[model samples]
Target: MLEFRDVDTFYGELHVLKAVNYKIEQGEIVCLLGGNACGKSTTMKTVLGVVQPKRGAVVLEGEDISRLSTAERVRRGIAPVPEARRLFPRMTVYENLMMGAYTRKDKAAIAEDLERVYELFPRVKERLAQSAGTLSGGEQQMVAMGRALMARPRLLCMDEPSMGLSPAYVEQVFEIIQEINRQGTTIFVVEQNANMALSIAHRGYVLQTGEVMLHGTASELLGNEWLQKVYLGQAEATPAPR
Candidate 1:
């Protein structure tokens, strides 16, 4: 489980996150939804320690990791499938997956996890020897997710997993995410596609200008007319759930 407690972060003089707070329970898929510049990706970076918080804490399970290094965070069971599928372009699919286990020392366990990833993304298995850059966008995204899974993270933080994918691929990605959660890894996904994200999420949070404006069970958010208009692109606007 992971929680962001009263976190405040800034980029030089500009404050980007304002007391942002949320929690992802174990075995749950929680989605953070917001428009561009709403600090969705920044939240992921803060959790990963790519950018330290000016105040507050990023707690994993019960330990405060706000001051931990990015590598330490990964070693402590936080792995990311970043937006835009940031993969090693020149690396073969198998090699890229091997990079995810850099923090682990068990070669046997690493090899087992590689097979597990292949099972999850069969397309990746088929392209094991192919260069990552040569794969299709969807295939590359699968590699990114597979690479993160190789780390054996307790909490997998995905930033905009659906960005730039076709609708069919987006649906496929969400299905895989749900399956991954069913297998016991907690997922904290920051997504712009509210409908797709919330469809597979247990709970959802809405962010606006770096503030948490609404949050609730996925069903509650889906039915809320206000969220439907503001983020879900529906015609009616109802009172937002608190």
Candidate 2:
């Protein structure tokens, strides 16, 4: 549902995301993984319209949305949960979710989606009136996801959803991500949690120094020798289905 072709991006003259090309198909979960300083996050930002590409295209379905404003992109059904769970600290959980649907005029639909978000995240529902800033890291992440889902996106872009959480929380986040995809939202996620990412992704892409270094099925990448060495610390291990 999303495509990036020959994308080159920069941050104040520091070139990043060099000629990256890939596609995220409908109802598919695709991941971008790499070490620190790689352009994985940059790739996501480019897709979200936070970082504009100097060259190439960011296409959503059939349209080339290279120059679309972020709000415009959201209206077109692209929603993102950024790296740091960006939420209104002082806003109540319910209020935070409502803000996500600000672009929509359908109150009934927004209410239904809010109900679905609560169903997906029970904790948020239980504390709907509580201040968002008071929640734990994991709870806050849930709020972030809930807010993004409020937009009812066709394609969801998640950047480091599992970051800054305990192992248990990380696993929780992954489970939710899987459930979201199973419910038919095409997901393009950038994560450092390689094991979790590759485990659930339909396909994966490895980025490095502003370029795509690897691309294949999730199982193919999970079993790659170089990938094992770089992330799992088993340099000579045999490839095995995850």
The 0-to-1 C-alpha lDDT of every candidate, in the order given, reads 0.94, 0.91
Task: Please give, for residues 1-242, the per-residue lDDT of candidate 1 as tens digits.
Answer: 89999999999998999999998899999999999999999999999999999999999989999999999999999999998989999999999999989899989999899989989999999999999999999999899999999999989999999999999999999999999999999999999999999999999999999999999999999999889888888775667999
Give candidate 2's error at residue 175 in angstroms.
0.9
**Deviation in Å, model 1, residue 61 alpha carbon:** 0.9
Q: Measured by TM-score, how close is model 1 to the native structure?
A: 0.96
Clash pairs for candidate 1: 226-238
Which runs in model 1 stand beyond 4 Å of their true positions? 236-242
Best lDDT among the predictions, by candidate number? 1
